[model samples]
Target: MSDTLKHLLHPKFLHMTLFGFSAGIPYFLIFSSLSLWLDQVGVEKSAITYFSWAALGYSFKYLWSPLVDRLPIPYLTRKMGQRRAWLLCIQLLIMVAISLMAMTDPASSVSALTQMALAVTLLGFSAATQDILIDAWRIEASTDKDIAMLSSVYTVGYRLGMLTSGAGALYIAAYLGTSMDQYNYFAWKISYLSMAATMLIGIGTTLWIKEPKKAAALVHQTSDYLAVVGVFIICVTVLILSYQLTADFFQSFRNQLFAWSQNRPLSATLTTASQLLLALCLATITARLVATTRWVNTDMIKDVYWSPVKDLFLRHRQHIWLLVGIICLYRISDIVMGVTANLFYQFKGFDLDEIASIVKTFGLFMTIGGGILGGFLVVRYGIMRIMIIAAVLSAATNLLFMMMVNMEKSLVFLTFMISADNLSQGMALTAFVGFLSLLVNRQFTAVQYAMFSSVMTLFPKILGGYSGGMVEQMGYANFYLMTAVIGIPVVLMLLYARKNQVFEFDQQSDQKTSPH
Candidate 1:
């Protein structure tokens, strides 16, 4: 092997790979796995919609990102360095939270399970924090040319994690030899415990890894303690003000808000007073923190206190526009089709058992294959070409479902449709992630990626919410055909974006302007 390839295969690279695995595994445990468990337990479809909202945690992770970016664990911060210390802490929490979730039963007491959902939410938050650090470490550890290979390694580990959570868990349930309902819940608990165990591997890898050197300038910038405090205070105040304004709208229109909030208590007087108190306290503390901590000798503190929000907007205008467009169009067809697929199966007379076994189990492997394949393709060909091809394939595969919808109810046709869809989805997801990774400035990886992912999710998820009503309005054949048609606009946009060479031009301009 070339020395560069040999270096990448060394123990340190393996460590990062395993750590990536640990971070990726629990995500589906709280998401897709939980969805299956809920479906099996006979949760109402409408209630299941609320459960899906729990996924909003992944999308909104940017809210606490500044905290993760800034705060230190009293002694560990100095011992392990900022990034590794934070990563280790969050991994431990994820381990503990998953074990806690294993002990709760969703059917017996949903309120208790809701508490478990909160614990899972905590896991998602911590996992996201770990991802922020890992992405930074990956960038710093590799040379520019090695980035594609490193990304592929990370993708392989991530897909392996997903396989364990999705298909592995299902197989365990199937083999347990219990009633279908009991086996489903038992399988979930076991899967969570297994996920917890996976963290140990990451922890061991982290211990052996060396910390990257801190930049001298970054250290100098954070020495101002008062500035750090001032920035923290202002950020907190803005968050509080935003929340209070939202609360006021809810209170003023209690009936509408209550419906959405599921009738959590709301009164105008209390809402007004609460908002005022929160705003004042937040503003006061923020002012004090920024003033006191502006001179701390840390990059962490500077990032927290600085005006990144404004800077990103002004500096990378074209890139930002590309980010917005990619986010909006990436999964438009897949999500829209997904929202109605279960109903389609039901209409075609497939039992729940058959649907779960075929789509959730076998189809998952197809997705894994596609992810691994796309990763290799990205390494072999560049990200730009892989992205264009993936988009085209994703759009084309929607037609497979349209074809299946016209065929008579046959398991063979169903399998074909599921396999094709999953393959396209996996390939598209791999490319999308790579593209997003390239766009992020490692300094702001978590927040920028979060913004991209959140916008990507919001529109499709909203459209998905109306899917059932649409299926009711239009029959199955028409619905699938409509989904196929939806992919055309995004595919065209991708082709145009590629032909114009937007990202390439931006990179050239950036390199020209940068100081040598």
Candidate 2:
């Protein structure tokens, strides 16, 4: 067998895909599939969009990633090592959270919706934590020679997991008789319960794998672990109090914007911006709380919280803001468009079964193809070149959706749209993820990568929360046009960075050190 085939078949690499799959499941469940559930239950468009905030835990997960990098579970850590122990523990939490979500009926009452949203928040938080540990483990397990391949495998697994939660869940729901005209809560409940069962794949993999060298070597005392846990608890308490205190102010502010603002776009923009700012403020308060505590004096705390930021700024001070801009905006167009995509399809008169088969199942293969092609192009032409193409493709494809608005709902036309859209999505995400991974400092892999990932998704998700409102006010054609137009900024930023050679040095360094 060829060397590439050998590596693909390796057990270590196969397990990495499973880890990626596990991480991918909850993300779509919370973001994509859950939106369909809310819509079918007769939830208002704006309310469904607001429900998107339940996944904000993903945007702020960097806050607690440091703890995952070093914190140890009591008995589990001793038995299976830190990373695996955390993996198993978080997997169980996800299972419980998902099961709870399945049991709640969002259509029951406003209070029930609120409770269901909280359950989603818990699930999102657990899934985000799982991502942190799994990333660290993936990095720790690979040598420099194969990290890229391992990352690709992980991406494949992650996409496959998306397939399950995205298409598989829809198939189940449709089979059990949930449609736009009729709301079958039992259908959705059974679908989610089945999705929850798939968490077993991750739990089994966690138990089957051995701890990597770096993860195994990360040993801390009982007192230090307890102190870190205390610090985490304090931060959580501060975040909760901060949100509760400011919730009314933000709500009133949003109300005023919608009530008085003449320009609808401006109103939507201000509302989303204010909510993003609130999230950032909460994270800042948590950070400040951590710093002011006695734990700040501890070496572990210093290394975890301060050192990563310091190292990143020190290394890239001149280009740090530009890099941040790129990371923050790179995926904005795709995410914002995706937030309302299923709703848009349903509005266009497609049923759940049709959407599941074409958009999810068929689109899955196209995306995987694009991802593989993207990985190859990045290898041949470098990330900057491929990323530019990916960006352009991503922005340009939204125009197809715009055209689809005018055309009749032919399966052929829908298939063509899905092909173009998912291809761009797959390519853009593959390049973007690889770019982020390349920028991470190995010393702070978990924390720094988490920070990068968190920042990248933060603004996009914030904007996505207003997507339904945008659709409500601007209409579908304009929304798709706006999504496309926003990609201009990302392209401009990439061009500026390329002109200034911001990442040239890092790429050179990686190439020089990597084995050929």
Candidate 3:
């Protein structure tokens, strides 16, 4: 085995793998599983879709990332490093949130159930925080050359968690219930408790691992606390002011803009531009206010909380852009198709049993296989090449589902499509994660990677929200085909990126140009 592969197979890699599993398992429990629970209780699809907005907490994790990066729990910070301390705490929160979700039923009165929804939202936010810490640890603990191997291991663990929470939880629920029509409260509670137990494994692993020693200068001091509070106040003030300003501005201008554009059709571009401007204004005001608060002056908070984001961006512009593009395109096809898969299965007249057996069970294994294959390929061939191949294969896999759209829904064909789609998704996801790790600076790994992964999720979720309408309009066959075609622009972008040697050249250039 190559040195990288050998290192990946080491015990530390296994530790990271378990950590990834702990992080991944609770996600679907709060997301898809919870959606099902709500649906079973007769929650409207519109309400369920709104619940998905709870997931926006994940996308905005960067907001609190600096805390994970800087603030250390008193004894925990001393016992464990920033990353581990943050990971363990957030994992604990996730456990609590999941258990609470299991205890409550959304079918109860809206006033009573609002707390339950909040609990699930908390779970998502906590999980997102844990993800930030994990991403930081993964990058900090590994070397550039070993990142691919580490990434693959992490992906394997992550996918396993997704599979268990999705299919495994469903099976458990199905088996425990007396009838399919009755609610499986006990089963769901056990499954959620099981998820909590699995997270403890991560806590144990964290305890066993040695904390990364902080440099003396980097250690937190009293001033850090004051700075943190100051920054917090400034950030809050700016957000409130910006919201008021924008709301007032929009309300004032709405009629005028509508009148001017009466004859002019509103394109997606115009809509996006309007939203973008509002968001940019809010973000800018918030950041500027935070900077003015002077929270960065103290030693404890200086490096931890108020370090210069602008400097990093300027220093790593090319890599940052590449990271953005990779994140945006990594699972474009998979995410787009995911929004329509169940409907497609139903449209084909496949019953729940067939769908569960083929797509959920068999399909999950194929995904694991693809992740492992992609990881191995990265170790063997390098990340860039693996990324190229995985992207192309992912695009191609969409066609398999399209072909099945009009077919007789044979078991063999279902198996074939599931295998192709899942395997390719696994490969692409692994490569994409490895690439993300490479882009992060170890000093700000959690915050930077959180930003990247958040962006990775944001666009997909926004686009996916409309997927049901699209499928309803175009029908399943054409929808799948269109999903496949969506991959084309991303593939072309990847090709252009590779040909330009974006990351490679940027790294070399940074080294040569740095003021040592």
Candidate 4:
């Protein structure tokens, strides 16, 4: 290994890889193992897919990331500092949740298993929380000079963690006699418990690493944001619940006032309108009450939560819509096309072993290499230029898969198409991430970046969820062609944005250019 790589192995820095491993484990456990286990127990494939929604915690983590950034655990905050405290607190929660998920019987009722699967959601939630803090620690612990190395090591570690959980879990389960028609509950129980045991990796790393120097500063700023948000949400929920009362009361009044006409359709309309008016009145009154009420340490409710997001929109009001539009479109082709990759492989007649060998094992390394190359390409050609190229390539790669399905399901052909697709995705990921990095204001780094990222995925995921239906209707080739056609708009938008200079230097660059 190179000395820099070797340095990553040092005791002090080893935690990055450990953290990555920790992050990667839950991913496959929630998706792959859970799916496999459910299938083994004769759960409907559709139901299994629905449970995948449990992983949506990762997607919506940003909604609560602001609180993660600003809130501190009561006791741990005092002892371990902000980042470490949150990391450790959530780590234990995740561990406990995973352990509960492990103990859940596959023989349980669907509702019972679903409730147990919610434990996986909690696990995902805790893992996302840990990720936010880990990211904070990575930046604050390393100098700007070493950020690259830390990122590389952390990514390498994360991928390794994924591989271990995914392939490693399968191998372990097989050994436990849960493989190939065994649906062995005890065996799976043992295997899941085994997975839970591995969380000590994160626990050890959390305790081993020193809290970043800036932890105290972060905690101070995050002061009481959690309490304030909690109270606000509760007040809002209560006010919403108040609508039920108003609606009921208004319905009763309307019925009494128009008893003779109560059987008429017009009377029904009148009741609805009257109830809506009453609800509005009650809501307005409640709003005034909340505004006037001095609830628990109102001083801690600083503008930090919404300020960064508000500032971005206000400053870019001229072209913010256009910029956000480009972000949504850029990855639509890649994500939508990916939705059918496995189905395409199956359609092409590849067996599970062959698919796993080439697509899972070999494709992973190709993706990593592509990501590394993409990073270098971003350095050589600026992110905008490389991103445009990646967008184009991403759009074009769908054609390869479209062509592959017409063939005799050759492994060589499948490998080639998958490799090309993975490369394009890896390159686009790096460049797109760089592009997002350019958009964020450091003042609201967590919130701004999360907002950008969450929005970026939302459109793609929503659109991609329908891809199976698209394939069903149009067949693989036509579906892919449609996906490719969608990419043209993204290309046009990027080109226009470049022409008009819609986005150039973001907050970081502006800070550098500012007068001292």
> Can you rank all candidates by lDDT, best first?
2, 3, 4, 1
Which 10-residue span in candidate 1 carries the lowest summed lDDT? 214-223
Relative to the true structure, candidate 4 reaches a TM of 0.74
RMSD for all candidates, in order, please. 7.2, 3.2, 6.1, 8.7
The residue pairs in collision within model 4 are 70-222
TM-score per prediction, in order, is 0.73, 0.91, 0.80, 0.74
Ranking by TM-score: 2, 3, 4, 1
Off by over 4 Å in 1: 1-8, 177-187, 214-311, 335-365, 402-411, 442-454, 461-486, 505-516
What's the lDDT for residue 246 in model 4?
Answer: 72
**True-vs-predicted CA distance for residue 396, candidate 4, Å:** 3.1
Please provide, for model 3 over 1-516, each residue's C-alpha lDDT reduced to its tens digit, 9 standing for 90 to 100. Answer: 597456556787888888878777876776566655665566543345345545666777876777667766778777766667767788789889888887776666786468776787788888888888778778877876677778878887887777777777666665666123676567777767776677787788777776655311235654665566566556646644564556555644655565776522232224434644576577666666566555565454345544536545776676766556667867778776775565566457764456657777788778878888998777666666677788888878888887887777588988888898888888988888887777666667777788778878877666665565565456667877887787877777777776776776334534544477
lDDT of each: 0.63, 0.83, 0.69, 0.66
lDDT of 4 by residue, 1-516 (tens): 497667556664577768877887787677666766676677644345445445556555666677767677788878877677778788888778878887888567866686676687678767766766666565556553344445545655665665666556665666667644566777667667777777788888888888765542543344356455655455546644665567667677667766875443344445554654455466557544664556434444335545766878887888988878887788889776765565566456664456556775676566656666776665544566667888899999888877876777688887888688867776776667567655666566666666676677666755564555456557788988898999899898888776666775433333444476
TM-score of 1: 0.73
* Least well predicted 10-residue stretch by lDDT in candidate 3: 263-272
What's model 4's lDDT at 33? 64
- Of 1 and 3, the candidate ahead on lDDT is 3
